[model samples]
Target: MASYSIGDVADKCGINPVTLRAWQRRYGLLKPLRSEGGHRQFDEADIQRIEEIQRWIKSGISVSKVKAILDTNQGAVDKGWITQQEELITILRCVRPDDLRFKIVEYSQQFDAATLIDHVYIPVRQRLGFEQNTVRNICGLLDGALIEYVANQLILSRKRKGKPALLISWDDPDRTRLWLEAWRLSTQGWHIDLLAEPVELPRPEFFPGHHIFVWAGKLITSRQKEQLEYWHEQGYSIFHHNPDLTS
Candidate 1:
């Protein structure tokens, strides 16, 4: 039997450590044993439970729904006859191995390259597991066509905007991704400039009144974390998506 610490499980599961801790504290999905020094140590079963929770969330189930199902040990919840567990399974089973790639190719045919990249390919990647290295690799292999198309769409979409929002992303992010994410924000009328890292962000200026910043990276360090706290204090709506699922 293997017992892993919180960091170990987070790395293996492709989830953020903060998110893992929140799941335990907030959702009761994991109950790890604490070491003498108070560090949490979890077993394989705990890891699996986190994965299941991730899967449920991906299917649009709220954390409350997941907690209720876990608490009751029910096969599935009523949810008006459409169970979260069932819906997640269906989506997982239906996603063919190369569905994303195929969809990208198909989208290229119907829409101009940029439109395909923004509306089609980007959304497909968003649905994928962020921590899965394969998600980036596969998307990378298809990058040339997708990037070109998406960049064009973003340029075109910029004409009709409010000011932009600032963005900071992980270095070497799935290249096609961070840009598209910025584009998504921009389309919602936000002007954006992706920073080197959240910590590198300059103090907010008011030329175009850029007031928000988003961090879309693999990890956040302590210093960047302080910056995030500061941003929150300044009344920004910051969001981090957890991409891990347990079953």
Candidate 2:
């Protein structure tokens, strides 16, 4: 039962101290004892638990969901039927091993990607703001899940049936922004070329349609706005979009 400081554990585990703090604060993942001076102190069991949690997370399980497995030291979880919105809120309120993702993929068998996004995801998203956490944390947690499950499905569906459009962001678009535009364009039967950051757009001739979209977010700089306007002036048919992530 030797003690290790937070910095020492982070160095040994190759995990950022800040990330560990986030996991603990958000998910109750760690139960470290505090020192007299209020520093976190970890023991050998804590180190081993951290490694185990890291392995499960690397395999795509969300932090909030890993607690029960760790507590029980069990491998099987009972599967039950829950509404997609409920499952999604579960992903936010209490993680359960990518179960939300599993449900979306499962539902896709019965519904097309567009239907799922419109009915399941969009409705769930609208209801997310009333939750107990700060909007930023709530958005951050759920957005990650959407990216893993919903966004990936939309991207793949986009590839299957359409002409590719040029999509770029002034910087990395918010998860909501990227997924929403991707869904909208994909529903319109267009493929996508997503650039997560500010970069030069592809030459117009190469894409033929020159149907470019700039997925701007709330934090656009004056220069980025000017760059988008310049693209508009060049007759490239560019559109700027910023998804309403707060809602």
Query: Which structure among the candidates has the greatest lDDT?
Result: 2
Root-mean-square deviation of each candidate, in angstroms?
Answer: 10.8, 13.1
Query: What does candidate 1's lDDT look like per residue over 45-143, in tens digits?
Result: 888778767766764557767786555443323322123223322333454435434454454465453343333454344434443655434544345
Q: Model 1 reaches what TM-score against the true structure? A: 0.40
Provide the lowest-lDDT 10-residue window in model 2: 73-82
Per-model TM-score, in order, reads: 0.40, 0.46
CA deviation > 4 Å runs, candidate 1: 1-136, 170-174, 193-212, 217-225, 228-247
* Clashing pairs counted in every model: 13, 1
